[model samples]
Target: MPEYGPQPVERQLPTEEARDLLDLVREMARREVRPTVDADEEAGRFPRDTFRQLSASGLLGLPYPSEYGGGDQPYEVYLQVLEELAHASLTVGLGTSVHTLSCHALAEFGSKEQRSARLPDMLGGGTLGAYCLSEPTSGSDAASLRTKARRDGDEWVIEGTKAWITHGGIADFYTVLARTGEAGPRGITAFLVPGDAPGLTFAAPERKMGMRGSPTAQVHFDGVRLPEHNRVGEEGQGFAIALSALASGRLGIAACAVGLAQAALDEALRYLHQRRQFGRPLADFQGLHFMVADMATQIEAGRSLLLTAARLRDSGRPFARQAAMAKLHCTDAAMRVTTDAVQLLGGYGYTTDFPLERHMREAKVLQIVEGTNQIQRLVIARDLLGPEEG
Candidate 1:
């Protein structure tokens, strides 16, 4: 562990307000998140209080409109805020991203009435959210989900299971994607299901290598009913809405990856400067110096890619390809940098004595989530080369 803790990141913010936001976030991270991270992560304790605090501070809905309790901040600023949160504790960071993703379909496509009635509570009323898309048999092939939602008069009866739900049982609301019509992607539609909805249940959280404090569980909807107004977007628009949310969601993952990698790099540098070997500090070694340089370079490159994609999104431009690229590059770089940090620390890094091992484990999930790196490559190639001819 670094004696001074992780250093503050130097940011190129868009405005004075944004800068103040970052400063406030750093203070929260330092005061609320970093101190208890090790203990909570070790115990697999979810930081529900921290999330409530984030909601109270207006941090939960930074990128959404202020009209609905959001901060009205741009994506660029929001992603940076995610990075800082991740740097302090990945559970907080990734949880914030997932919560934001859960709000997307409603915020973007729901009717004005829906927005007026639901958005305020979802955005900042201390309610946590989960996005339900992938099912037991559907991961990367999300369009092939088997979840069914049949209409009965004005209500939709949802019967299906959602796998890998981040907030699962604990979420106050869930933005769920379920089949409502024919089959495949077009048949799918989104719904905002209340957490206390009858017939809704959650499996126990999955045991994972890292980010254990953030629960990941299977959400089961056994004929849960929702009113007609609960549907988000059109009856056959769920897949489109999911894809749109994921495009921006990928950038959130990228920012979190960069933040995790930066944390690793900070730890490694701290170790290098303090740990002495053969009558000299580890920092004096040329080999370790190059490693640090490479780690810093990768972090910078990842930050630039994600920020570029975020700015493009903020400007109302097409950024799906850039988001994929950023997700792929940044997660891969986090994997590399975190592993390198472990190597720099030798046996200490591999053990729970240092955070590097946790960083390494956490970085692996980033590469796989929000679409795997393989999926990202396919997405980027599709953007450039179009669909496969066969």
Candidate 2:
């Protein structure tokens, strides 16, 4: 019998270099991530070595400036890379997205001196980073975050807890948002806090339904201090910085969703052809293959939506609306496809012996993270209607 697995996605690339890069990423995913994802996820083991390998391969900073040790690829190419990684394993894919998000504030808003001093190591020197924006009390309402940074001569004292932080306890650095001026968005400021800072601490990772290998925990800054030079952009500018990062990050989530949906679809197709019912293969049934067709169509649609948004971002066009749409559609599609995949696989799908159940559980989080689907709808509405009238 022939083997059944995820085949390569046919992609249209802007250059031969981009095509080669995708090939490298696909090979890495097949060799390094797919084989052990099940065991590692079951064990709740974070793939630190895999991440180091990604960093060494220059994948950690694909969308940033080449002068700073980034790959300098456009978001178009970068997001496709994320999609392929996600097709292999969501933990790896989503982890990479969070790491890229963590670097956004500094890469886009930091001083040239700061970028020169820190970007090389962060981009490719095996360093991992976490983004800190949501507090224990504020998640979607990010502007209301309560973490504070008070100035004390040359150093700033930070005190508060950031909840739902990816790589919370294990990252090498943190891109933190803190209240530095008044209340609300205007008061917020961004800082680069070394993960080993004296007063920084983390709660145990959250036990979740899926993506177990990616740590999500609360990070506490108990009088953590940092020099004035660590500030990114300007004081009272963190909210804008965070929002900007999220627009791009939503595209990352969208790509991940498409990848995951594709994975589930691939598995469903493989099983259908191999499993027989009513004296014939399940795939021979018109109704069943029609379901598979819907799944593939959704995945393709999601992929196109994300790539369109990515190209918009790369071209300096406004993409927040499109990003929100992509995130909403792709994640919702993943949920539907994965659930249908389970139905197709029947009893076997519900068991740990198959990956369908895991895919279903993992798909649920994409709807919740990067702003909940409800939040995405609100964002889309706001863009369509202009800000809510007072």
lDDT (Cα, 0-100) at 92 in candidate 1: 97
Model 2 clash pairs are none
- Which ten contiguous residues of candidate 1 have the minimum total lDDT? 1-10
Regions of candidate 1 where Cα sits further than 4 Å from its true position: 1-7
**Compared with the true structure, what per-residue lDDT tens digits does model 2 show for residues 69-177?**
9999999999999999999999999999999999999999999999999999999999999999988899999999999999999999999999999999999999999
lDDT of 1 at 206: 98
TM-score list, all predictions: 0.98, 0.98
Please report, as a residue range, the 10-residue window in candidate 2 with the lowest summed lDDT.
1-10
Tell me the whole-model lDDT of each prediction, alpha carbons only: 0.94, 0.94
Per-residue alpha-carbon lDDT of candidate 1 for residues 142-250, written as tens digits (9 for 90 to 100): 9999999999998999998999999989999999999888878889999999999999999999999999999999999999999999999998999999999999999
* Candidate 2 Cα misplacement greater than 4 A, ranges: 1-7
For candidate 2, the per-residue lDDT at 233 reads 94
